[model samples]
Target chain A: MNVTIIGTGNVGQYLIRFFSKIENINLQICGRNSNVLHQFAVECECATVDSIKKIDTNADFTLLAVSDNAYKEVIEQMPNVKGIVIHTAGSVPLAVFGAKFNRCGVMYPLQTFSATRKSDFKNIPFCVEASDTDTLNKIHKLSKKLSKDVRFMNSEQRKVIHLAAVFACNFTNHMYSVAAKILESQHIPFAVFQALITETAKKACEMNPVLAQTGPAMRNDQSTIKSHLEILESNADLQKLYSFVSESIANFKKQEDIND
Target chain B: MNVTIIGTGNVGQYLIRFFSKIENINLQICGRNSNVLHQFAVECECATVDSIKKIDTNADFTLLAVSDNAYKEVIEQMPNVKGIVIHTAGSVPLAVFGAKFNRCGVMYPLQTFSATRKSDFKNIPFCVEASDTDTLNKIHKLSKKLSKDVRFMNSEQRKVIHLAAVFACNFTNHMYSVAAKILESQHIPFAVFQALITETAKKACEMNPVLAQTGPAMRNDQSTIKSHLEILESNADLQKLYSFVSESIANFKKQEDIND
Candidate 1:
C-alpha cells in the first residue's frame, strides 16, 4: 500500500521510520521545511515533499501527522485524494477530515514519541477510530504490522483517554518539576530523588495504583503533610497543588473504604 | 557483613534474597509471625527468628524493615548490641533511634520492593544517612554491595526527596487509576492506556519534564479543557483535581517564560 505522511516533527519522523520498516509499503514523507524533509528522506529512504499538493492522490493512505491546530488546514490542502485519510491525533475528532475522502480515521499511538529515542511500538496500544468498516479494517491491518496491541475507540473515548493522560503523564511530570524546583531551592541535588521517583513508577506497575498509593497525604499523616506544606509555603501554586492532590487521594481512600 | 532482616514483608523478603545472592554476606531473616518466618527461611535458605529479642546482635548489621508506625516498638524490643542499627525508612528521621546506640543509621532503598518481581538494585539509589561518619561509611559500603548508585544524604534531604517522590511516582500512578476509572465507566478497556503511561514515563527519563510537557492544559486550550471538565462533571473530586493541576501547569509555564 502507498502511504503519504504529513509532518516531519517528532511524531511524523517516528511514524515515517516505523512505516518504512514494514514490508511491501511505499512511503512518502512531507513537511513544510525542505531541509527536514530532505534529512528524513535521506535517513528513511522515502520520498519527500515540500507541500501537501505533492502528495499522490492515488496512494492507498494519507496519514496526517501534523499538529492538531494545523490538522484542518492540511486536510483541506490535500489534493482530492481517493485514498483513506487518517490523523495521528488524540484530542481532535475524526470528523475534522469531513466526508470528502473515500475513507477517514484516526490511528493514535498512545505513547509519547521523540526522535532521539527508538520507540518500541510493537507492544504500544494503537487507538484506531474510523468512519467506516473498510477504512477501519485497513487501519487495523496497518496497525497490526507495527503493533500487536490495537483497540477500536470512538472520538469520545479517545478524548477521555487523552484527558486522563494529561493528568497521568503531563501533570505528573509537572509534579516532578515542582518537586525538583523545591529541592533546588533548598540546595539539594536532583539525584537524591531519582531512585524514589523510579521506584514509585515500578510500584504502580506492580499493583493497582489506589492500593500502591503511599505518602503523608495518602496515609493522612497530618504531621508530615503539615510540615511539607510549610516547606512549600512560599510557592502558592505548589501549595495549592499539594493541598488539592492530597485531598483527592484522601477522598479516594475514604471512598475505597466505603466500597470495601 | 552478617545481616539480620527484622521483617518478612515485601521489603524484608526481597532484601533477604538480594543479600543472599551477594557472596560473603551471611543473612538471617526474622518476623513476628513464626509461620511466615519459617516459609521465608525455607524458600530463601536463611535462618528465621520469631522475636526481636532472639536477634543475633553479634551480626555486622541489623536492618529494621518494618512499618513506620511499628518502628519504635521493634527498635525497643531488639536486644542492645554493638552492631550497626539501620532502618529502611524514607520519612522517619534517624534521630528517632535516640543516642542509646553508638552505631545507628539508615539504609533506605528508594524503591518499592515486591516479592513477586525481582528488582535490579544496580540502578536503584540507596540513600544512606547516619549520625556519624563511621556508621555512614559502613552503610555506604553495605549499599555498594547491593547497588552501584549510593549517596550520602542528610535526614532533611531524604525527607524532601520522599516528598518529591510522592508527586513523581505516587501521584502519577493515581492519575493512571483515574484514567482507568474513566475508561471503565465508559465500558472501554483500561489496557488501552498502558502504552501511553509507559511511554510518558520513558519520555520524561530522556528529556527535562518541563520541555516534554504537552496537553490541553499545557497549551491552555480552554475549549478542549472545558470539554474535558464537562465530561468529568459527574466526578466532582476528579473535576477539582483536573482544574487544579491544569491551572498549576499554566501558572508554571508562565513562571518558566518569565525566568527565561
Candidate 2:
C-alpha cells in the first residue's frame, strides 16, 4: 500500500515513523518547507514533497495530519486522487472532505504526541470512521498494523470521545500542573508526588474510577475540605475549582447513595 | 526499638506490613476488637492489644494511625509514657497530639491506600514533623526504613502538602471518574482510555505539567470548546465543571506567557 501523509507536524511524523517500519507500506511525506522537508526526509528515510498539490494521487491513503483549523484549506489544495482521503484529527468530521473527494474517512489516534517524546502505538486506540464500509475496513486493517485496538465510530461518537479525552488527558494534566504549582510554592520539587500520581492513575484504570475515588471530597470530611480551601484562599481560581469539584464529588456520592 | 500501632485501618496495616519486615523493629498492633486484633497480630507476626490504654508504653514510638475524626478521642484515651507519640495524618497538626504528650511528631506518608491494593513504600514520600529535634530524628530514621524519600515538614507545611495532594491525587482521580462516566454513557468501555491517561500522567511528571498541557483549552480553540460544552449541556454539573476547568487552563496559559 502506498500512503502519502500531508502536514509534517508531530502527528504526521509520528505516523511516518510507524508506517515506514511496516514492510508492505510505501510512505511519502508532505511539508510546507522544502529545506526542512528534505532534511526530515533524510532523517525519516522516506520520500517528501514541499506541497500538498505535488503529492502523489496514486497512493492508497492521503492522511491530512494538519491542524483542524487548516482542514478545509489543505483539502482544497490537495490534488484530486482516486485513493481514499483520511484525517488524523479528533474533532473534525468526515464530511469536511466535501464532494471533491469520493472516498474520505477519519483515523484519529487517541493519544497525545510530542516531537521529543517516544510514543508506542501498540496499545493506543485508533478511532476509525469512513463514509463507506470498504473505506472503513481498509483503514481499520491499516490501523490494526500500528495498534492492537481499532474501533469504528461515527463523527458524533468521535466528538464525544475527543471531549472525554479533554477531561481524561487535558484537564487531568491541569490538575497535575496545579499540584506542581502548590508544591513549588512550598519550595518542594514536584518529583516527590510522582509515585503517588502514577499509582493514582494506575488504580483508576484498573478499577471503575467511580469506585476508585478517594480523599476528603469522597469522605465528605468538612475539616480537611475547610483546611484545603483556606490553603487556596490566595489563589481565587484554584480556590473556586477546589470548592466546585468538591461539591460535585459530594453530589455524585449523594446520587449514588439514592440509587443504591 | 519497640513500636506500637494504635489502629488497624489501611494506613496502619500498610505500616504494619512494612514495619514487620524490618529486623530491628519490634512492632505491636492495637485494635478495638480483641478477636480481630488477635487474628491481625497472628498474621502480622507481632504482639496485639485490644485497647490503646493496654498498649505497651515502653515502646519507643506509639503510632496513632486513626482517622482525623478519631484523633482527639484516641489520644484522650491513651495512657502516657516516655516514648514519643506519632500520628499518620496529612492535615492534622502536631499540636493535635497536644500538651498531654511531651514528645510528639508526625509521620504522614503522602499516598492513597486501600485494603486490597498492594502499596509499595519504597518510593512513596514520607512527610515527617516533630515538636523536638530528638523525636524528629527518631521518626526520620524509622521512616527511612520504609521509604528512601523522607522530609521534615512542620504542621503548616504538611497542611499545604495535604492540600496539594487533594489536587494531585483526589481531584485528579475525580477527573478520571468523570471521563469514565462520559465514555460509559456512549457504551464504550473506559479501558480504551487507559493508555492516554497513563501517558498524560507520565508526561506531566517527567516534565513541567504547564509545558506539557495540550488540547482545545491550551490552544484556545473556541470552536472545539463550544462543541464540548454543547455535548455536556444535558449534565449541568459536568457542563459547569468543563467550562470552569477550560477557563482555568486558558488563564494558566496566560499566566505562563506573562512569566516567560
Candidate 3:
C-alpha cells in the first residue's frame, strides 16, 4: 500500500510514524514547509514532498491531516487522483471533497494527542467513512494497520461523536483548568486532586458514568452546593458554570430516574 | 490509639477498615443502627456501641463520617469526649464543632468513593484542620497511616479546596456522563471514548491543564462549534451547557494570555 500523509502537524506526524511501521507500506509525508517535512521524513524514513500536486496519482491512499479550516484550500491545490483521498478530521464530512475528487473518505481517529506523549493506536477508535463501499473497505484495511478498533460511521454519527469527544476530552480538561485556578488561589498544589481525577475517569470508563456519579451535586446537597457557589463568588464565570453544571447533574439524575 | 467511628456509611466503613489494620489501635463502631453496627463490629473485630454515649471517653479519636446535613443532629447526640472529635466532610468548617468539644478536628479525605470499587488511600490527600496543634498532629498521625499526602489546611483553605474538587472530580465526571448521553443518542458505543477520557485526565495531572487544552473550543473553531450546537438543539439544557462551557474556555484562554 502506498500511503501519502499531508500536513506536518501533530496528526500528520502521528500518521507518518504509524504508517512507516507497517510491512510492505510505502509511506510519504507531504507539507509546504520543506525544512520540517525534510526533518520528519528523515525521522520516519519516509519520502517527503513540498506539494500535494506532486503526490503520485497511483498512490493507494492520500490522507490529508490538515486543520479543518485549511481543508478547502488544500483540496483545491490537490491534483486529481485515481486513488482514495481522506481527511483525518473528526467534524469534517466526506462531502467536503465535493465534485473536486471522485474517491474520498474520512478516517477520524477518536483520541486526544499531545506532543509531549507518545500515542498508542492499538486501542484508539478510528472512525472511517467513505463515499463508496470499495473505498470504505480500502480505508478500513489501511486503518486496521494502525488500530484494531475501527468503525464505519456516517457523517452525522461522526459529527455527533466529535461533539461528544469535545465534552469528554476538551471540556473535561477545562474543568481541570478551573480546578487548578481555584487551588492556585488558596496556595494549594493542584497535585492533591490528581489521584481523585484519575480515579473518577477510570470509574466513568469502566461503569455507566451516570450510575458511577458521586459528589454533592449527585446527592443534591443544597448546603454544599450553596457553599461551593459562595466560594466561587469572586469569579462570576466559574460561579455560573458551577451552578449550571450542578443543576444539569440534578436534572439528569431525575431524567434517568424517570426512565428507569 | 483508640478510635471510635460514629457512622456505618461508606466513609465510616473505610475508616473502620483502615484503623483496624494499625497496631496498638483499639477500634470501636458506634451507630444508632444496632444491627449494622453489630455486623461491622464482627467483620472488623471491634467493639460495638448502639449510642455515642456508650463510647469510651478515653478513646483517642471519634470520627464522624455522616453527611453534612446530619452533622448537627449527630454532634448534638455526642457525649463529651476527652479525645479529638472530627468529621470527615469537605465543605463543613471547623467552627461547626462549636464549644461543646475541647479537641475538635477534621480529616477530609479528598476522593470519590463508590460501593462498587475498592479505594486505595496510598496517594489520596487528607486535608486536616483542628482547633489546636495537638489535635491536628494526632489526626495527622492517623492520616499518615493511610496516606502519605497529608496537609494542614485552615477552614477557609479547606473550603476552597473542596470547591476545587467539585470542578476537578465531580464536574469532570459530569462531562463524561454528558458525552455518554450524546453517544447513546447516536447509537454509538460509549466504549469508543474510554481511551480519550483516560488520556485527557493523565495529561491534565502531569501538565498544566490550560496549556494541555485542545478541541474546537480551544481553537475557537466557529464552524465546528456551530455544527455541534445544531446537533444539540433538541436538548436545551445540554445546548446551554455546551455554549456556556465553550465561552468559558475561550474567555479562560484570553485571561491566561493576559496573565502571560
Q: What is the DockQ of candidate 2?
A: 0.82
Q: Give the alpha carbon lDDT tens digit for every residue of A54-108 in model 3.
A: 9877888999999878898899989988889999999888888999878899999
State which candidate, 2 or 3, has the greater DockQ.
Answer: 3
Worst 10 residues of 2 chain B by lDDT: B32-41
lDDT by residue (B1-260, candidate 3, tens digit) is: 78888887767777887788889989988877777777777877899988778888888888999888889888988878888899998888888888999989999999888756777887889989989988888889889999999988888998998888889988999999999999999888899998899889999989999899998888889988999999999999999999999999999999989999
Q: Candidate 2 chain A: minimum summed lDDT over ten consecutive residues — where?
A: A35-44
- In angstroms and one decimal each, the interface RMSD of every candidate reads 2.1, 0.8, 0.8
Task: Please give, for residues B147-191, the per-residue lDDT of candidate 1 as tens digits.
Answer: 998878788887777677767766776776777677777787666
Candidate 3 Cα outliers beyond 4 Å, as residue runs: B32-39
Please give, for every candidate in the order listed, the TM-score of chain B alone compared with the true chain B: 0.95, 0.95, 0.94
Residues A1-260, candidate 1, lDDT per residue (tens digit)?
89999898878888998899888888998889888888877887899888888888888988889877778888777799888888998889988977777689999988777667787789888889899898899999989998998889899888878777777677777877776676776687666556566666666655666777766677677877777787778777888888888888888889899999
Shift of residue B233 alpha carbon in model 1, Å: 1.3
Residue B36 shift from truth in candidate 3, angstroms? 4.3
Clashing pairs in 1: none
Q: What's model 2's TM-score?
A: 0.96
Tell me, per candidate, how large a share of the native contacts it keeps. 0.62, 0.78, 0.87
The fnat score for candidate 3 comes to: 0.87
lDDT (Cα) of model 2 = 0.89
Off by over 4 Å in 2: A33-36, B33-39
